[model samples]
Target: MTILIPSYEPDQRLIGLIHKLKEVSGDPILIVDDGSGDDYRGIFDTAKNAGCTVLTHRTNQGKGRALKTGFDYVREHGIKDDIVCADSDGQHLPGDILKITEAIRRHRNHIVLGSRQFTGKVPLRSRIGNSATRMVYAMATGKPVQDTQTGLRGYSSEMLDWLCQVQGDRFEYEMNMLLEAPKAGYDLYEVPIETVYLDDNKSSHFRPLADSAKVYFPFLKFCASSGFAAVLDFALLFLLQWMFGSLFLSVIGARLCSSIFNYTVNRKIVFAGRAQTTARTSIPKYFSLAVAIVLLNYGLLHLFHVNVGIPLFGSKLITEISLFLLSFWVQLKLIFKSA
Candidate 1:
């Protein structure tokens, strides 16, 4: 297996990690100098002297681009071994790196993650950021991953092409990998690793606000689309009910119109490039879901208004609120599941 380290304005800690890694494994270590400039040339020279294939970028590119550079090099050179990508921030220990490589060897087709358990004294930013991301990731993909921000990850040779094609350039690229993994047909395996924070992770280049926005942008877009569709649905239902005093007709008219809008926005915007099946196949499934939801929505509205003695508008509002999350979940996990 090959070890790929993407370095940008790195310190001596990276050199130390490289030396340690060399002692542990005889595999080739490729370091991408992501525009570390002339001042850092000596360090790259030292790494080269100590036997590392160093790749250079004239200008600083994001971590994702640096990683793609390394993967591209491996593919161009026809290196067929699995690759283990480890961070140069010294947080990823040589032992843990070896563990990830071993996991890749054992599970050849799986993407192995060197997961860290956040126990003991973790930095406040790290804790909150990871927690928020974990929750959002679970909600969006219906998958539970302990550490979504870990940099020590392993990928088999077959995944190199796909990894190169995944979207994003900064920290968001890593998040995108985890989000798209299930849809891309890759099983995920986590290997426990040491959680080491140097000076409370002060060396990390991640811009919390900017990068977090990019990471959560897709889910946020989905919410916006759904919210807009819900508003349209409610307005139509109320208007149609007022015009023609018929709950069934109102429900059907509102759902038919709203479902068309929802499906278009979801298929074209919210879950773009993540569809598991063709539009022809998924459209029927989505229509079926819309029909079922319309029936359930009407039933709940009738029960709430007649049996529970709630006002018609109040029942409509309650029923819509109750089904909001379920609709999103079903569309995400089933309707738009990656084929």
Candidate 2:
């Protein structure tokens, strides 16, 4: 397994962390000094002498950008193995890192999370913030997640590429992984890891109010637009029923209206693209494929509600879970080529 560490002006804390890592395994370690000032040069040199590959940023970027830098370096180097990524802040234990690596070896297709037990006298903000974000991630992706903000995470080479592609430039970068994993056909797994908060947990860079907004706003925006689409769908269905006098036709019209609005909004806003032209061209194809999804929605709804006697409202809920995956797959593959 490969080890990646993203650091910012790392001090003796980082030096000690590297020593611990080297003792555990002989994997190639990449230390990304996120534009740490001249003060860290000696530390970097010391780490290099201690057998760790150091990658430097010209200036201090956010933690997410630093992680992207590390991932990009690994991809460019053509390393054909999975890697375990840990923060340089000395919170993660080397033994837990090994456990994460072992689990990754078993489940290469999964995005392994190092779930931290926040049982001790952790900071109030840190505890509440982690709990909130973890629940949001699980809800948004329709997958269960224990800890969304843990830095001791492991990913395969393919997952590395996926992480690099995620567009957040700050703390939201971790949240992006949870949002896009389902779209990219990867699942989440958790390995329980010990939590060690130093300095009474005052050593974190997380901005309580600002970063929390960044992390949760994406999901909130998604929900707000979905609410509007739901209203639009109902309006269209009502109008169509009044004009055409056919219930089935009205429901179909409503489905088309809502699906189109939903897909268009998600493509443009939720999964913003790098290639301008490709994104524009993918909209039509997205709808074309969505037609098949419409059929699926109807079939599942009918099977659960009519055939199996499930309540109509609850059936729609169950069917939407399937729709979420179906639409996500098509969007990643058919719409934006690089999800």
The model with the greatest lDDT is 1
Which 10 residues in a row give candidate 1 its minimum summed lDDT?
Answer: 321-330
Clashing pairs in 2: none
In candidate 1, which residue pairs get closer than 3 Å at backbone N, Cα or C atoms, i.e. clash?
Answer: 276-338, 276-339
Model 1 residue 162 CA deviation in Å? 2.6
Q: For residues 76-112, could you state the per-residue lDDT of candidate 2 as single tens digits?
A: 8888878898988899888999999999988988889
* Residues forming the 10-long window of minimal summed lDDT in candidate 2: 271-280
RMSD of model 2, in Å? 6.9
**What are the per-residue Cα lDDT tens digits for candidate 1 across 1-339?**
999999998899999999999888999999999999999999999989989999999998889999999999999999998999998889999999999988998997788988899988899999999999988887777789899889999999999999999998888999999888876889889999998999999989888998889988887887898789889999999999999999999998997898899899999888887676788988998988877887889899999999999999999999997676667778888888766
Q: Report residue 48 deviation for candidate 2 (angstroms).
A: 1.5
Instruction: Identify the runs in model 1 with alpha carbons over 4 angstroms from their true place.
Output: 231-256, 276-284, 287-323
How well does candidate 2 match the true structure in TM-score terms? 0.68
- Number of the top TM-score candidate: 1
